[model samples]
Target: MRTTDTLNVIAANSRVLVGPLVLLVVLLLLFVFALRVGIGQIISLSKKVAESKVEEQVLSQKLEILKTSEESALPLADLSLVAIPSENPALIVISQLKNLAGEKGVGLSNIEAKQTAAVASIFHTEIEVTVEGEMGSLFDFLKGLGSISPLLTLDQVIIRQESGIAKVDALIFGNFAPLPTTLPSITSPLDELTAEEKDILAKISSYSQPVFTEVTPSGPFERVDLFNF
Candidate 1:
């Protein structure tokens, strides 16, 4: 009877522990699965970070190369010329006018500037200057103005002879575009324009001829000679 009671006690304790032990084992398995999922997420995030770093490095290298290329491509003056402002042209139109008037021994009387549309489809400003002078003075003025670098065009002329002074109205056109900032790869300034180009300019001058015509007496107009440059 004592041996049988001892065995029965042992069996009862084993049965009581079985349910708790099984529950503990299931919890451990769930914990292991959660750890594996967390590790995979961390690895994926690490790989993304590494890819981003590589992309950033490549972009930085490309930026450096572009910077170097820009530095070597052109000079500051060339850049400025290329980036000309529409409101103010690269060439100083007023300064050129003053120089031309000074060189020709002509006095500027009535100078007027009016913004006009450009035929080239680009927005531009045009100045119509009216100057009064003797015939000889006007001729000298025109010659000096025409001789300016980067050529000038005389567009119109209306002249009148009055009181021993020939009154003239001349319209001159100036280009707002700047001259090439980069000169030809030649040693001398004279080589900037080719012989062919010079010849072409000479022909143009011949075609334009004396930008002014002899005064006509038929118009009911003011005697003031309006010179537009």
Candidate 2:
């Protein structure tokens, strides 16, 4: 009877410990799964950080390149605008023509201007004028007109060279475009000016820009009071 009771007590103790052991196993499995998930998240974050670093480096390089380009490209860009004006260049071209005529010993007369729209959103001014001088001077004046900035195209020229004196009638055209109102996308890559473009800019830069002097037109000089309207 004593041996049977001892055996029954041992069985009861084993049954009581079974639930705790099972609970410990479940807790251990949950902890292991949690650790694995935490490790995976850390690795993912590390990769993201590395990628971000590479992007930052590339952006920094592009910024440096733009800074260097701004210094070198600004003058050429301004020259390009002067070469192809953003407004009607008729007056400017007229001034240049007069200067060229004076330099070439030619007389300017019958100046007329008429503006008309051309293809490519371009506006051209048709200038009809007469230049009279020696045959050589007239030819030189016409050549100078073509060489002036903002492009003066000679549509027609009627020349009468007799007795070393020539009278020429020219129909010249000058054009300009409207300025752009929209900016390009910032994400687009900047194209560096090629050698050919740089050479073209250099040639255009050599063209003489007209200088305007504020001269008082002949008028009655009268001292008016500043308070007078």
Top TM-score prediction, candidate number: 2
Clashes of each: 3, 0
For each candidate in turn, the TM-score is 0.38, 0.65
Tens digits of per-residue lDDT, candidate 2, 35-96, equal 99999999999999997787777667668767876776657687777667888888888899
* RMSD of each predicted structure: 17.5, 6.9
Cα lDDT tens digits, model 1, 141-182, are 766665553245567776777676666666655544434568
In candidate 2, stretches whose alpha carbon ends up further than 4 angstroms from where it belongs are 1-65, 161-164, 212-229
Candidate 2 clash pair list? none
Which segments of candidate 1 are over 4 A away from where they belong? Answer: 1-91, 121-124, 149-151, 177-229
